[model samples]
Target: MKKNLFFALLLTFGAFATSFAQAVNDTVYVTINRLPVKVNPIASRDSVYAGQSVNLTVTNCIGTVNWNNGLTGGSVTINPTTTRYYVAQCTSSAGCVGAKDSVRVVFKSLISPIATSASICFNESTTLTAPSTCTGGTITWSNNSTGGSITVSPTSTTTYTYTCTYTGSGTSNASGNLTVQVKPRPLAPTLVANPASILTGASSTITASNCSGTISWTKPDGTPITTGVSGSSLTITPTATTTYLAYCTTNGCSGPSASQEITVDSPIPSVAFSAPQICQGDPITITASGCSGTYVWSSGQTTPAITVTTTLSNYTVNVLCRTTAGDSAPKKIKFKLN
Candidate 1:
């Protein structure tokens, strides 16, 4: 019985020791090493004009950077003449691996600019247009205007030049020119009227000078005087004051006109009798006034005043005023004899 108890105690102690060691050894402490972070490079700008430069940099990379194009640095400058893509990688000093990063850059180019031509009269306005769109450049006209189109009014024939200044990666200028043709205009003509003043029914002549081309006469309202006006001189019989102007035309262009006026005058006489009644042997005198031209009487007298003796109970005399152009209405006086 004593030997059996000793063996059983020994068995229980071994089991307990085994269980304690297993519970303690089950918990473990270890040191871990993590993989390095990859680097991704970013570009400062995604697009640039031709001949312009851009920068590509790796932000998280604390060490040397390598590009697919064999460039090594934290940042690299890219000058692309055309659209292209770029890639770069970086590694940190702490064994961090860099991620592959790529960016696409677009380049802008310039095209030659062109200008259109036109024909216009002097001092007339017209427009010029550039049909092509400007890329990476600005279009400027010789008149110092900026745009695709511009309007100008020039006095004489002119040559217009347009320039395109490249503001992109390229630094240069493209130029083209066109001419605007202008037609010449004649100078104003001078007009003169011969015998500027005349009596009624008298004809006067008008002449033109300093005319560049065919002369045309018109009234103040621009209506042509007479049909088919073709000469420089015109003979007119005007009853009152009248005005006429002459203009010259050539090559579908006309110049200013000169105007001239001719004056016409008419005269009428006034008469009075010296006595209203006269005896058979008595004499009577008549006087005329208010006329600077010649006077004629019904009794065949051509003087300003006349005297007549008549035996009839009643008598009548009439006088008329005459000018170089024509005669005026008659004036009459009556006399009675006893």
Candidate 2:
């Protein structure tokens, strides 16, 4: 009977040891406010500016709540413009375990105002006003004109606009039109010449009145006669027998003032015979005068002076005068051959 009792006691001791080991490995579920608890991560605010701090609140079940950062806190704040995750684990006195839910943090850009269009012209001034909806910000012009309004002076017809930007909070844009009218000075003086008739190689002068700035002349052939002449009067000479036109120009304005037709006539040619009488088969020399070019003889000879070998006969010689000015005329020489 005594031996049986000892064995029973050993069994009881073994059961107790097993129960203690099981208790050490057991997990305790964390409870909050007397209910099975879950801590969904809390964000500080739905919307906030960059660099603003955001708070995240978490609840844990047991022991001390150990954050992934090795910190113990019921709440935390961070400025995260990037993807971030929060991990919290709870420890219990009974070696139990619990974990808070994790969350991701994301960053976004803030809204700001920007300028859309701006321009300026010469001899004119313009004013620009800022848009009203720009929050916590002021207006600034690139031209050093500040405040909600600015002014600029341009030399000509101009357009002025500016970017409306908000410095802080929210931003927006606005634009205004400023018209500057600068009356340009009257266009340069122009001269118009009328058509006329004149002798070849003669010149005619045309004058313009009330003309400002330098004057220029153009020929009928599209050639520029004078580049710039200070006075209103311009003269052009005709070299050949042709119609000529003259135009007066000042600044950007120009018109035909006058035109003239000139005529050039060829003088008569003088003839001289080598001899008053010539025998058959004898060579005779003939000379012509008042001709400017090669001469053509009836005997098929070409020269200013030619020698002819033939029987006595009457012959006529033709002479042509040509000028560099594109002038050409013919003169006839009559002579007797005996």
Candidate 3:
């Protein structure tokens, strides 16, 4: 009984010692709650058209965590115009964890207006204007004119500038320049026989008014007419019944256009026969009427009357006639054989 009690006491003490050692040897870890990230220029920072970049840094971290760019380190570079987010996590030696922080980078552009020119007539005044965004800045005109807008009576090509100022952002400025090209207005052309209508194969003339250069004419079908005619008039001949277009072109500028319609009358030829009915071996005559030109038969006969001997049940004669003016129609004659 004495030996058994001694063994039980040793087992109870051994269990207590093991539990106390484990509790003392365990480690406690610390973590950062949340760190804030910020970009140097806040959000939008306008620069020139060349290019620019913004800097970003991290703050609100008690200790340095794993400075990773999400992959490994905590720093990232990006274009200012582009939107991007920076992520960083904090890790402590005591095994503490922290939330990632994000910062946005943006770019705003401050550039001058592109140079442009407009055409104006002689003795006409043109206004030189700047872009609408050119505000809060004083315009230093290159032509000695002040303010964001300027007026000038230019007989030739002239250039002017407007320097814009942004008082809120110090001496930042944007320049806008414009050129005015002075030119005389083109003279309108005179259309001769304007809006004329004729039959097919007919022609009309159109003249250019006050034109110092060579005149050119374009038909509605995009066919160009010969400009070497006797005078300023252009003769437009249409082969087919079509709407013709006439325009005077000089010095790369075209005048007002005019159109004419040519109606071709190709009426069906009137036909007649000497004998409506004939017996076999009887002679029949086919005639074409109401046509001005010489008659042509399908049987190779060109006379107005063709004498034919009938043998079949019926005979059909077709005559085609064309006038000198290209007016044409077809005629037919039928003779019944009994």
Error of 3 at 288 (Å): 79
lDDT of 1 by residue, 1-338 (tens): 99999999999999999999999899778845343346677777676644456778877766778787778887887777878778766666655555677778876554433334466766667777754634546788888988877887888888877776665443546566678877777777887877777777778888888876788888889888974333778888887878988887776677878889887755558877797666687787889986657888998888989998876667688988876546777887766554
Q: How close is candidate 2 to the true structure, as a TM-score?
A: 0.28
| Consecutive 10-residue window with the lowest summed lDDT within model 1 | 108-117
What tens digits encode model 3's per-residue C-alpha lDDT throughout 1-338? 99999999999999999999999999898855443332122223333211334334444444553433443333333444444454566654454666665544433444444433366666677676665565445667777777656677887777666666555423455565667777654555555553254334556555555666555556677887665355666565654556645555554445556655544433456666686566788787766675556677888887878888877676677787655455455566666654
Ranking by TM-score: 1, 3, 2
Candidates 2 and 3 compared by lDDT, better number: 3
For residues 1-338, write the lDDT of model 2, one tens digit per residue.
99999999999999999999999999989765432245556666543334545666665454555566556666776766655676766556555556467766655443332223133323334554555543344555555566765665656655444444433333333333344443343433434433233334545455655545445555677676663333666655555555544544433435434554444433344567788767777877777665444454555565667776765566665655433323234456454554
Clash count for each candidate, listed in order shown: 6, 16, 15
lDDT per prediction? 0.74, 0.53, 0.57
Candidate 3's TM-score reads 0.35
Q: lDDT rank, highest first?
A: 1, 3, 2
Over 4 Å off, model 1: 1-122, 132-137, 164-173, 267-338
- TM-score, candidate number 1: 0.47
